[model samples]
Target: MSLFNGTIQALEHSLGYSSAKNRAISSNLANLDTPNYKAKDVTFKNYLAHEFSRPIQAKTTNSRHIGFQGDTQPAGYKTIINQASSYQHNGNNVDVDKEMADLAENQIYYQALVDRISGKFGSLQTALKGGR
Candidate 1:
């Protein structure tokens, strides 16, 4: 189980990040017409860097050695609720073009991550079935 712990953790992190990002984007879209609404974004890279900076414990051959415990939710993935420059007369700062582009890109990345995780599981399944 320790052998695949890193991969599993990475997949989980990716899924969580994507889900949070999607939620933030959806919220922004919903508030598009709200006065003085600013779009929020998830800081995924910062989270990854922070997580990577932490020292990881390696499993030992000793019977008493405990396995490494990864973070359930890493820090630095904070939502930035910065105010956007208002261009419209209604004081709304939502940029439809940028939002749409971001949404599409995020969706594509999420799908790719899902596919990769699925492939990993498929490989595990194949190995478990004696490589049939």
Candidate 2:
């Protein structure tokens, strides 16, 4: 009877990742003119893979095992440093075009995830109301 099922959890995680990516892109854009400011990025592929691969196990020694912990949601996004391809005259490494593109893409992804979560909740609501 968990309101946040696996799909919901995954979508939430993706939303978090998108949020982090958006923040990173914003930071990079903000420091585009700052001297010696290297662009940073958040890696989500590895985290998504790890989340998918990890099994949700309950702490139990007998038949009366507790599933509360196992029912908890997965971890959120993580930020990491990104190596810049080139450095500018002022020692800044942020590429404006790249950062803009990343921001746009991340925004799209975030919106899609939000839509999916909304749809899921809508369906749950419909089910609860007996399809009324």
Candidate 3:
């Protein structure tokens, strides 16, 4: 009876993660020249692992609710800052090459998720249309 089931919910969350990564990458790139601006990023492996390990389903009764609540999302996003290493003389840590790579990778990830969701909807449409 639910419109967004587990797989669909997972895809939605994946898209969210990809978007957050994109924003983080942009922020890092934007501060590339700022002195002492440490680069920040949302890690994928750990975040996905944590997301899959939890089985709780969070519900939002109001539009004012912010971010995923309870154990379902476990902080929703964990932004990691690069502090162990610095490559610039001004104490900034933004790695342009890595950020570019991450941006491209995140774009691909977002595209893949969108493709999957589209496929799911296509199947649903076919079913609704009484296709054999």
**Among all candidates shown, the one with the greatest TM-score:** 1
For candidate 3, the lDDT comes to 0.82
Clashing pairs in 1: none
Question: Compared with the true structure, what per-residue lDDT tens digits does model 2 show for residues 19-131?
Answer: 77888888888888888787898887776666776777544657776554434345555777665555688878888888888888888888888888889989989999999
Judged by whole-model lDDT over C-alpha atoms, candidate 1 comes out at: 0.81
lDDT of 3 by residue, 21-125 (tens): 898999999999999999998876776668678656666677897645455544456678888878899999888999899999899989999999999999889
Give all TM-scores, in the order shown: 0.79, 0.76, 0.76
Candidate whose lDDT is highest: 3
Q: Mark the regions of model 1 whose C-alpha exceeds 4 Å error after superposition.
A: 1-3, 52-73
* Each model's lDDT: 0.81, 0.76, 0.82
